[model samples]
Target: DQQVKQNSPSLSVQEGRISILNCDYTNSMFDYFLWYKKYPAEGPTFLISISSIKDKNEDGRFTVFLNKSAKHLSLHIVPSQPGDSAVYFCAAGEMNRDDKIIFGKGTRLHILP
Candidate 1:
C-alpha cells in the first residue's frame, strides 16, 4: 500500500489568496516530512520540511504543518501568485530507513490571475 497519499488531484486559487494542500500517511515510522514543487519539464525542487518533533515550519510565503498523532500534514502558501502554480509532492522519510523517502502522487495547484 502507498504510505503517503495526496487525495486531491488538483486545486485552484486566486492570485493574492491562500493555497492549502493536504497530505496523509499510514506509516507511523516517518520522522521527517517535506514538500516539493515541480514544474513542467523539470525536476521537483525542495520547498519546506518539518521534523516530527515540530508541528510547524515556515519560510517566507510557504509554511508546512504536521500532526503526528493524526498522521496528516499540510502546506500553506499565503498570497499565492501565478508563478506558484505547479505540482506539489508530499514526501516522508523514516529515520532508520537509510534516508529513503516516500513521495505522494502529487497535487497540481493552479493560480488564477
Candidate 2:
C-alpha cells in the first residue's frame, strides 16, 4: 500500500513556540520525502524535503527528519508564526514513470495569538 499516514489531524501552538508534526509510511520503496504547507482554499506549497539516506534536513525555521528503518518522519517548526497556521502534508514517493508525487491527508496547525 502507498499510504502515508498523519495520525494527528490538528495541532494548536502558541506563537514563538515549536510545532511538531509526525508522519508514517508503509512503503519501503519511497526514497524521497516531502512536507507541504497549505493555507485555506490554496494548494499546498513545498516546505522541505529529505532523501531516504538522510536523517535530517533543515530550512530556516523548518526542519524535517527521516528515519527509514522506522518508516517515520517528522516536521518541526521553531518559533512558529501566525502565518505558519495551516495544514501540513507529508508525502513519500519514488520517481514515477512521469515523475509525480503522492500526498498524505495532512494535519492542520493553529497558531494561538
Candidate 3:
C-alpha cells in the first residue's frame, strides 16, 4: 500500500488567487513532511516542509499545515501565478530512518490567466 497519497490528480486556480493542495499519509511513523514542485522534464524542487511537532509552517507565499490526528497535510499558495503552474508532490519520511522517502503520485496545478 502507498504511504503517501494525493487524492486529486489535478487542480486549477485563477491567477492572483489562492491555490490549495491536499495530501494524506497512512504511516504514523513519518516524522517529516515535505512538498515539492516539479516541472515537465525537471526534477522536483523542495517548496516547504513541516516537522511532526509543528502544526504549520509558512514561507513567503507558501504555507503547509499538518494535522497529525487526521494523518493529513495541506499546502496553500497565495497569489497564484502562471509561473507556479506545475506538478506538486507530497512526501513523507521518518526522522530516524535514512532510507527512501515516500512520495505521492502528484497533483498537477494549472494557473489560469
The pairs that clash in candidate 2 are none
> What is the alpha-carbon lDDT of model 3 when measured against the actual structure?
0.97
Question: Model 1 compared with the native: what TM-score?
Answer: 0.97
- Select the stronger candidate by lDDT from 2 and 3: 3
Taking the tens digit of each residue's C-alpha lDDT, what string does model 3 give over 1-113?
A: 98999999999999999999999999999999999999999999999999999999999999999999999999999989999999999999998888999999999999999
Lowest summed lDDT across 10 adjacent residues in model 3 is found at: 93-102
Off by over 4 Å in 1: none
Which residue pairs collide, candidate 1? none
Give, for candidate 1, the lowest lDDT window spanning 10 residues: 93-102
Superposition error at 56 for model 3 (Å): 0.5
Worst 10 residues of 2 by lDDT: 95-104
lDDT of model 1 at position 108: 100
Q: List model 1 lDDT by residue over 39-110, tens digit each.
A: 999999999999999999999999999999999999999989999999999999976668589999999999
Residue 10's C-alpha lDDT in candidate 3?
A: 99
Best by lDDT: 3
- In terms of lDDT, which candidate is stronger, 1 or 2? 1
Q: How does candidate 1 score on lDDT?
A: 0.96
Q: What shift in Å separates residue 76 of candidate 1 from its native position after superposition?
A: 0.1
